[model samples]
Target: MNIRFDGKRALVTGAGKGIGRDVVKKLVECGAETIALSRTQSDLDSLKQECPSIIPVLCDLADSESISTALKDCGPIDLLVNNAAIAICESFFDANTADFDKTFDINVKATIVVSQIVAKGMIERKAGGSIVNVSSQASLRGLKNHLIYAASKAAVDSVTRTMSLELGPHNIRTNAVNPTVTNTAMAKVGWSDPVKVKAMTSLIPLGRFAEVSEVVSVILFLLSDFSSMVSGSCVPIDGGCVAS
Candidate 1:
């Protein structure tokens, strides 16, 4: 199926690097007017250089006020990608309040807040929109040292389902993408050891981790008209890891 987002406006958080960066680039290529939010100005500058059509916004997801201020003048966005997240790997017994708070603030709370703000605009304009939350496979299955991170993402999945029910009346769709260990710099640090890679890959039916583009493809699909009836779902981009 040919999916095109011509004339649509999309906003992606954590758009400075990794999956977010790839999503922004792909959105632009698909003819969408993209607004990218990132904490680093240099990364935004590099993104702008690569895709001149994208509008960059500097925002820290951890702060509630920052999210509101950054999106204040972003105009009406038809697609929202809540992709900003941080993983503080600590065992359940050892995880502290600070780590839990920080993880939830960015991964869960910020996603809800951003979607609320953007959805308000969409409702006001009478133009229904699509929202995709970037969650993790750990949310569905237990992972070592991912206690807090997994919990935060599980909350994200809940938010997706709840929002879909509330927003469906307004013709707004909400969903989440749960990807397994992706080939990104941040993830590479954890899976760098050959033993770790083999152990993890062996469990995946596909016998490989996902590439950033693979995740982006699913994000774009959900955002496009191709997934008009899809909502309140957690689409796994795990290369068959969930299946295994």
Candidate 2:
């Protein structure tokens, strides 16, 4: 079966690289008029240079004002992927107020801001929309030095459920994709240790890390009409890691 979004519109955050970049490209391929939001001008430039059809909005996730200004005039979105986040590694012993504040400000607050604005548009249009929040397997089960990141994602999961309950009446759907340590640029930083990687992957039933495409595929399904009945669900894109 072929899935298409020939006339739909989509907005993706953290569309600079990795999962977000792939999602933007795939949406364009599937015929959605896609908007790519990134804090980095260079990443946006390269993405635009490559796709040529994406609407690029440069706004820092940490700055709510900038995000508001950037999206104030954007046409109503049919799908939204809240993929922008920062992972600050801090164990329980060393967790600080600064790291926690910064983590929640972007991961939790930014997701809420974007979803609220787009949801209002959807409600007014009465056309409905799908929201896919990029949560993490870390939120389901803890790991070493993931205190702030896990807390923020867990908060996002709550946001997703609340959005589903409130927005479902308007035909809007809200869900999240919780992925394990994927082989992305973000993974290269803390996951470079083979010993750590081995320990984590062993827990997964599939015995391997997640891939960028794997996560994006699930996000697309959730964003599309194919998942018309799926809402308030935290779908794991892990290699069955969460279940194990």
Candidate 3:
């Protein structure tokens, strides 16, 4: 029952900040060799400074070529946490088509691409691996102005299920962690405007957002042997939002 990932290798996307950053830190603490990927070199450097055990990789997940190259460069991994995502706060109709494309490309396509690359290695080696995708409550329930974001996450949920079936024989478990509004840098955008923040706070049953570490803790459980039988599942970390 001791959930330890000692000697395992992990790769976490968008790990330069927010929940992804916490995920990487937790993995390192759990004795896993973690490679943190992000687009910002400075953020990657900061993560390296904070967790010297974590190797930082600079790559934009939205860029397919960059993602393919980076994962290949990193060689193989036992855990892949697809935690990078983007959202467009504008109304569905008002949001530019380009924004929608960008959101899906990163939230869905990139995840698919990276999983393929990493899973291939895991399969070939006959090594059991785990993939924890970062989904959202939006994928389970609808939200205003969540058109593109919701669609992308919904796709991720579907991919998780499909991958479980396809990769099960290879012993690769694919699952997702669905979190409600969290107090990360991503959540503060637009909502940082006091009025917007107040509006959002009113919607949650808990009347508050989650701390990044809280989400990371669940992610670590899923990544470790603690969740050995879990696959194709969407575990919610929402604060009473789904309950209500």
Clashes in model 3: which pairs? Answer: none
Model 3 residue 213 lDDT?
80
Candidate 3 local lDDT, 31-71, one digit each (tens): 88999999999999988999988888888887898877776
Please tell me which model should have the higher TM-score, number 2 or number 3: 2
- Compute the lDDT of residue 33 as modeled in candidate 3: 90
In model 1, the worst 10-residue window by lDDT is 183-192
Residue 41 of model 2 has an lDDT of 97
**Candidate 2 residue lDDT tens string, 111-181:** 99999899999999999999999999988997888988999999999999999999999999999999999
**TM-scores for all predictions:** 0.98, 0.98, 0.94
Off by over 4 Å in 2: none
Instruction: Quantify all predictions' global Cα lDDT against the true fold.
Output: 0.93, 0.93, 0.87
Q: How big is the positional error of residue 142 in model 1, measured in Å on the Cα after superposition?
A: 0.7
